[model samples]
Target: MIMVNRFSRLIGTLIDRAAALQHIASQCILCAAPGQKGLDLCLPCQLDLPALTQCCQQCALPLFDHKAYCGQCLLSTPAYQRVEAPWLYQPPIAQLISRFKYSRQYSIGKVLSNIAARRYASAYIDQKLPDLIVPIPLHWSRQTIRGFNQSEHLARYYSHHFNIPMKRFLKRCRPTAAQQMLTADQRRSNMKGAFQMCGDVAGKLVAVVDDVMTTGTTVSEASQCLLKAGATEVHIWCLARTE
Candidate 1:
């Protein structure tokens, strides 16, 4: 029986490796062209991705000028110190995100995560890296329906690539209406007191990871919760930002 179990485990491992290689040998998700080199996207499609060239350092909204803060940030500051979103929420990228988030197309998600990870590594090479990465949590009910949290998957990729620890330090205490359906004020009100700390973050610098940032209310509320739980500082990291 012991030998049989060992043989089964080895077979399973080999099967998994073969599946991974097959996936890497597949074509691009966008253009259907070959030579992806392990990515689900082709080099041309990757280069054509809409990047956030001029954005506010605080909120990551696209800016017309070379300003650190946008007009909105000047009026009011967010709880998180800064946001780093490498791409704009635009076509092809938007479609990829939708497929990843709603349809559980994990290959698309992996492609997006790889781009974001590379951008992060280059941008933060000389800067202070966060001690921990905390993904924005979904309520249990929503997670049960979705089968996975897109944010957590993206965070996991970053953790693996950057050698940083990813922790589920916060929990969603209750379900809230989708942020896209609500007005900015309504979104802020809906997220209030929605998160509770799951672990101690005392004096630790944290980077909150998410797939997208729209009104910024969700991350703001989450940052406040982490700060209340004794986190020294909070930074926002997302794949895309909407203007």
Candidate 2:
């Protein structure tokens, strides 16, 4: 029985390792070079991706001054207490996001989610993890066309990696115009009252997940909804941010 148990454990380990390798891309998605460290991107390409090293604590806008918060954030803090985005909305990363979002490229989305999971793990090393993960919802009309919400896909990855529960707690109250097409001021107004909280988040620390944050109006509106629903604190997490 002891020998049989040992054999079983060894087989399980081998199977797990094999499954992991199967998921690792054999060629880089961008350069067709060998994939790096199980990612679909080569090391050179990965290093070339825009990283948001310094940014506002509240908004994740790239920072130039040696200050913790940006001038805009200092002037008027956002509703969410914090925001984290690992990459800037630039080439390669931007292209990858476009493919993942519009082209329905699951492989690209997997790579993006993996990158986010790694960064977020280190980011909260000394901070408390949120009590719940919430994905920004798509209105049913739009979701019917897209077939999936990209934010929900990323949120699921975070929940699994961090061993935290994820909930679709917010509902898109109305289908708003595409944010990218609107001016900054128009974008802010477009997201107004766009989200409604559907669950009891009273006193809970909630992390809201999205694909990209441009003017941050969408996330701000979502955060406001959660806060009004009694959430103690709200944090925004996204794959990329536009500086």
Candidate 3:
């Protein structure tokens, strides 16, 4: 018992020292300069990143002028009540996402997710946090091929930051063509019957998490499934949105 306790303490000390060394040695992932505030980014690059300042309250589409909701959202309300994205899909943000999503660089993903969570924490100060965080699911076959789900990682960060439970409430029932290859109308049609609820969400406020939103069709479909399962409300939370 004495030896075991001593070994554990030694391991803990080593881990603490390693973390401190990492902080001191950190460099910006984008510029390879010294990182700031323990982020894998410098202050200048962080400030210069494309921010989603003015956008629709409902869909989060970039707006030319300040507006409560977009024109399309006003005509056809989506299943989700609102969307919140911290960045526009441009520049270093897009490059970071591509690395995280395709290159299997989880360190990059963690950096992006951390920045997004901090921004979201401030944005939701006046609003109530959701009861659950649900990640947009990938089809099993695709997930198997990819070896992981990017949205799930994002959801995990939000879950920890907000102290909300993360649940796999929705699952992709069928595989569909990649949304990136489809037109807006085709994307909408392709997602039909794509998601199915796996657990009861009756009267629960669910925040659906995704890496990015383009046409917003994927999240909309997932939200519809949660609503059909009797969720009281659904909100979309993503890292970035295409302008």
Candidate 4:
């Protein structure tokens, strides 16, 4: 059943891209090599995608083993229940995020979300999929500046693939400092009271989606809000986690 659905999605994507491919048919995204059949990437560039096979089950850090939590996650603990990320924040994927988010190539959001949905389906079949997906919210000011919230786009992709629902469960209370510029302590403090749960997620399984997670502070704060709103658990599904 899952395989059929995935195959259907792949075919649909290919058909959807048929028109767009006319302009860039033989191009590899990462290395600028040639392309294969209909894939946007040549085999080499596609195969070379940086991935994290071994990581902490709870935190998604590139790790020595699943049993070994990263020292940071072990020390203070995080608010999210579990984490899953297919890629490490490196190379082509990292640059892809910049091009997508900072450059207004919103198409990247759909591409990354599709990749994440496929990966998540492959890895987690038996687990109960989340009852609802929540995008890590951006403050209106920042969203105004950026024009749109990338995470919201990514969350919608996952919601479509998983046949689950999506809700803007949390809202950014205000524009906190850009987390990239903050110290770990500062990151935590910056996000404090930055989000509020606006609707019921009580006793329901929730998955929070995002593009990249660095210190996990943003998702942690978001999860804290949902928990306070009575969510049973909050797993994180992100495109990449910085190692």
* 154-184 per-residue lDDT for model 2 (tens digits): 9999999899999999999999999878998
Task: Give the per-residue lDDT of model 3 (tens digit) for 63-88.
Answer: 98888889989999988998989999
In model 1, the Cα lDDT at residue 133 comes to 96
List model 1 lDDT by residue over 24-115, tens digit each.
Answer: 68778898886365677778888898999899888999987888789889998888998889899999778989999999999898888988
lDDT, candidates in the order shown = 0.91, 0.90, 0.90, 0.84
Residue 218 lDDT in model 4?
90
Q: In model 4, state the lDDT of residue 69.
A: 82
* Cα deviation of 148, candidate 3, in Å: 0.9
TM-score of 2: 0.90
Best by lDDT: 1
Among residues 3 or more apart in sequence or in different chains, the pairs in candidate 3 whose N, CA or C atoms overlap within 3 Å are none
Q: How many backbone clashes can be found in candidate 4?
A: 0
Per-candidate count of clashing residue pairs (backbone under 3 Å): 0, 0, 0, 0
* Candidate 1 deviant stretches above 4 angstroms: 1-24
Error of 1 at 82 (Å): 1.3
User: How many residue pairs clash in model 3?
Assistant: 0
Q: Mark the regions of model 2 whose C-alpha exceeds 4 Å error after superposition.
A: 1-25
Better of 1 and 2 by lDDT: 1
